[model samples]
Every structure is written in structure tokens, then in C-alpha cells.
Target: MKISYHSPHEPNCSICKKQCRFYDSLREHLIGPLPKAECAKQFSERGCSLCLKVFPTAQQLNNHRAACQSLPPLPAISGLRPSLVNKRNQAEKEQILEESSNKSNISGIAMDCEMVGGGRDGSLDLCARVCLVDEEEKVIFHCYVRPPIPITDYRYDVSGIKPEHLMGGMPLKQVQEKIQQILYNGEAIWRIRLKGGKAKVLVGHDLDHDLQCLGLEYPTHLIRDTAKYIPLLKSNKTSNSLNYLTQSFLGYKIQNGTHDPYEDCVAAMRIYKKMRNEDHSLSATEFVPENGVYSRMRQKELEKMSPEALLQISQSDFYCWCMDSR
Candidate 1:
């Protein structure tokens, strides 16, 4: 093939500019064709000579010789120093176990609130009930808190809680404290373990709001939300109500008409456990990087996963970012 060069100082070669069959003959008249042997050596060092990208030095070029375009992209975590990452991973694992141990033996709690039909401005009506359950699913604590706002929806059809139920109920502050006490008491044993170590996991459905409502902050790793575990439910398909996951996973229909604090708590814990088991299994698999042809093929398979699945993989702490970056 003919070759052409552009330079303001030198006159252009007609034969080189034209498409010629003999590159070697033209090479004699111009800068000689890159020394074949040298080009091959550079190829082993710098990559395709035709690409014309320069390496910092010949040494770097030599190192690039083994480079292959077929390799899979490096994982995101690969950029992290291996020694530092290992230490952080070990620390996180220890923290999880310590938190689990601290919270494990403690019973779970469920909460439900009744509100009026006054839109967002409307205040919560009736009592906000909290039910604390032990391992056997028995309620250990239950109480109702009278809200500060007036009850506008006294119609029996709207809120099942009647004015009579509020008569003997404690104030909202007292109710909140009582609920906190029960939770604190149940977790006291774990706290001792945690003091010697760390905190335990808290299982709940839409728990972020609940924890906020209760004025509590739970550790992110310890807070397991059933809503996050099943992305399929969250995607534009169906409502992520506790009732759906309960019926789908546990095969038990719940929240038919009124809310049951005890039942809701049990369901949340059950769902959390199930999802945790699945995550554990996925974590056990060994990750391997393919080389040459196999690397390209494996990468194509990974690309086939749904965007959501790929995102989950990308976010995973186990995945090496350095590997993904490549």
C-alpha cells in the first residue's frame, strides 16, 4: 500500500501520495518502512506500530508487549491497595459478627400507627401501638400512645380505634419511652456483648422510617430492609407493601384490614433472614480473572446480565474495583 507524509518544509512525493502496490520501493525514496525487526520488537514493547501512540520509554514498551485487548475489564476494587483492602474487609467482617452477636438473642419489635384522612396536614389519630416479640413470636410488650393531634376520623368505618381506647392510654411521650424501654431491655444482654465488641443487626420492612419515627439510628450494615432485597418488587411492577412479600415468600396473607404490630415484626425478621442467606451464598463464590481469549468471552457473559444485576455486582464490596476499571 502507498504511504503519505505531511510536512510544511518538504515537498510531497507524487508516487507516495498515489496508491502504489510496492511499499518497499516507495520506502527507498522516503523515510524507510519501519524496520520490520525493530517494528516487531516495538510491537512486543509498545503495541501496534500503526497505531502510532508512544510509550514513556522502551522499557514500558517491552512490558506492554504481553498486553492483549481481549482481557476483561478490571474490577473496581482492584484499584485499592490489596493489603489495605484486606485489612478493611477483615475489620468489616469482624464488625458484622460483633453486631450480630450483640443483637441476636434480643427479641424483635413491630410498630403500627393509625392516621386521620386530613391529608399530609392531618395529625395521627388514635394510638400508635408497639408490640415487642421474643424468639417464640410471643408478644412481650404492647402499648398504645395517644397522639397530640385531635382525632378527626372518629367514624368507625375509617379507624377501628375508638375514643374509648384513648381513655386509659398514656401520653405519646410516655408511650414512646415505654417502647424504647422494651427495645432497650430486650437488647440489654446483647449490649454487654457489644460493649466487649459491637452492635447487632436490626431487621425491619421500610425500617428507615420506623427508626426515624422512634428517634433511633441503626448501623447501615445492621439494618436489613426487606424492600431493598427484592428489586423486582420495587421496579415498576407492584407495590412493595409488607403484605406482598409476606404472601409471596412466607405464604401468609397479612395486613388484611387493620395493622398488627406483632405479626408485622415477625414477617420483617423472617424476610430479612431469607435474603441474608441468599447474600451469604453469593459471597462464597471465588472470583477469577480470565486471560487472553477466555477473558473476552467471560466478559461478554457478564455484560449479558440485567442492568440492575450488573449494578448490584458493581456495588458489591467483594468486587475489586481495579478489575472493573480495566
Candidate 2:
């Protein structure tokens, strides 16, 4: 096997192939004040806003953006703190929660869980705490859970879960029922499953594991797992940790000391809302046929199609949050 010696951190410009210290620098090279003229123009026509990669056609770029996280408009993530609540501000936080709770018809919510360990080796993940937040990053539900099995490993360093915390906590079964009520609103489970009830979209990082630990079932269509999101993955197509994704994209630090499910919940919600907030106005010309239909188009036929027509025919591998706009 051959080993390469170049610095892997430095990436090349997608259009000019110029070396840059970082992806941001490469992006600046194409779009900054002193940008390369040809690359700038080409990028403007077909560049992916999130990845900064140039695609072959505008339609391809549009398809790529569908799977990517939308641009972050918030202030720099570093200068920002996690908004730790102190005794003085506790009332304010409670007031905010009360205000948030009054708003019905919440279309989306993000959840995060902290786990303690069970089993002989203390390797089994047992949900010890859960937090859910609405689009406003207001706490909708937060609880420490009493696991069915006895706690073997507290994992206090990461989870901050202590025995006394679960002393008066809600039982797992009760917790599950409460969550379903909030998610489904007043609709019956069958209405949500079969009749397309307005069940709130669940957003989280590695949500499959969270949902499994909770022993809850939601339609896959309504769950947005950030870990499984295509654009949030590494270049090698591996999952990025929530901390890494938060810092890299959202421009801040999280999971700083002890893990707070509320903080994680807010971060995940911000990412989802940002991605879903894109103004992807769909025209009559912008519609893709049903699955397995577009691939039948011949190469020559695809070449002759207009960019909008090509977009109309193209399909995304994952259901993009942008579709939530519809």
C-alpha cells in the first residue's frame, strides 16, 4: 500500500483546483471580494452552498442542496455560550416555557437523550434522561427517567446522571405515553399512522437509537435523524458526531462539560429548522416523477432536458427537510 504525505486538512478549490487551508478559505476564493472570475461565475451558477462543491449542472446543484444543511445565519458559535440557567433567570426560563407550551400546532420538535448503562458489563444503553424542544428552542418536554433495569454504570462523566436524580422520576411506560400524547396532539394513533394526522416531526441525532431505547414507534417519514442525514456526513460518508457537526456547521461548542440533553435538543432543532427554512419555491416545472421512473430516461434525452426539467426528473436519495416547506 502507498501512503500519501500531503496535508489532508487542506482542500482544493472545486472549480480552479487551487489549494486552500480550509473549506472556508476555498469558499472565499470562489465567492470573496477578490474571487477568481471564472470560478466565481461558474460557482454562482452551480455551486452547492453548504459543501462549496461545484456540480456539473444547475439541476445537480439544486438536487445536492436538497440533501445539504442550509446556511447558518446565527452569530458565530464560539462567542456564544450555552445559556446556562441560574437561580436569578429560572423564572424567566419558566415563563418562556409557559409561553411556548401555549402554542398548539407545533409542526416540528427535536429530542435528545442521555443514557446510563445496564447489564453485567454495563454496556447496554438505558435512557436515563430525555429532552424535547420546539422550533423556538423552548423546552416542550424534559424528564429524568427511571429505567426498568437497575443502573449499573452511571457514566457520570458524559451523562451526569446520578442515582438520586432518578429517585422520583417518571417510570418508562408513563414517560412513553406522555411523549406520544404530545407528539400526536389529540389525534388517535391510527390517524397519525394511516390518515396522515398532523403528527409533529421528530428531529434528533441518531434518533433510531433514541426511539429504540424509548420503545416508541413513529413513521420513518416523520423522523429526521441528523446522524443519517446525507450532507451532514463526512466526505467518506461516515456519520459525524453531534459535537463535531455543531462546531463545524453551527459555529459553536456543545457537550462542553457534563452532557445536557436540553442543549443537545436545541442544537439539533436549530440544524433542522435551518435546513427546513430554505426558500425552495416550487414551480409547476419543478416536480419529480415517482421513484424508479426518471432513471429510464436515456442519456441523450437527459442532455436535451432544461435545468428545471432535469430537476423535475431528478430524485433525492433521502427525503430532504426542504420538502417540509411543502
Give the TM-score of each candidate.
Answer: 0.46, 0.68
List the global CA lDDT of all models: 0.44, 0.70
Best by TM-score: 2
Judged by whole-model lDDT over C-alpha atoms, candidate 1 comes out at: 0.44
Prediction 2 TM-score vs. true: 0.68
175: Cα error in model 1, Å? 2.6
**lDDT per residue as tens, model 1, 1-326:** 11112111111123223221222222233334553454345434544222123365787655644441112212222133423432345456445334433554653444444333322444433444444444444444444445566666653443445566555545767656545444444345356346743333445677666665455555564455665543314434343777776764555576666555666767776655443333111211222332212255556766686643433233232221122112
lDDT tens readout by residue for model 2, 1-326: 11112222234567766655344467568888899999999998988655577899888887876666433333222222223211226577456455544467578888888999999989999998887888876667676788999989999999987786777677899779767877777468998778877777889999999999999998898899889776566656678888876775566678877887877887888777766764443423323334434344454566686754544344434555777877
* Lowest summed lDDT window (length 10), candidate 2: 1-10
lDDT of 1 at 280: 18
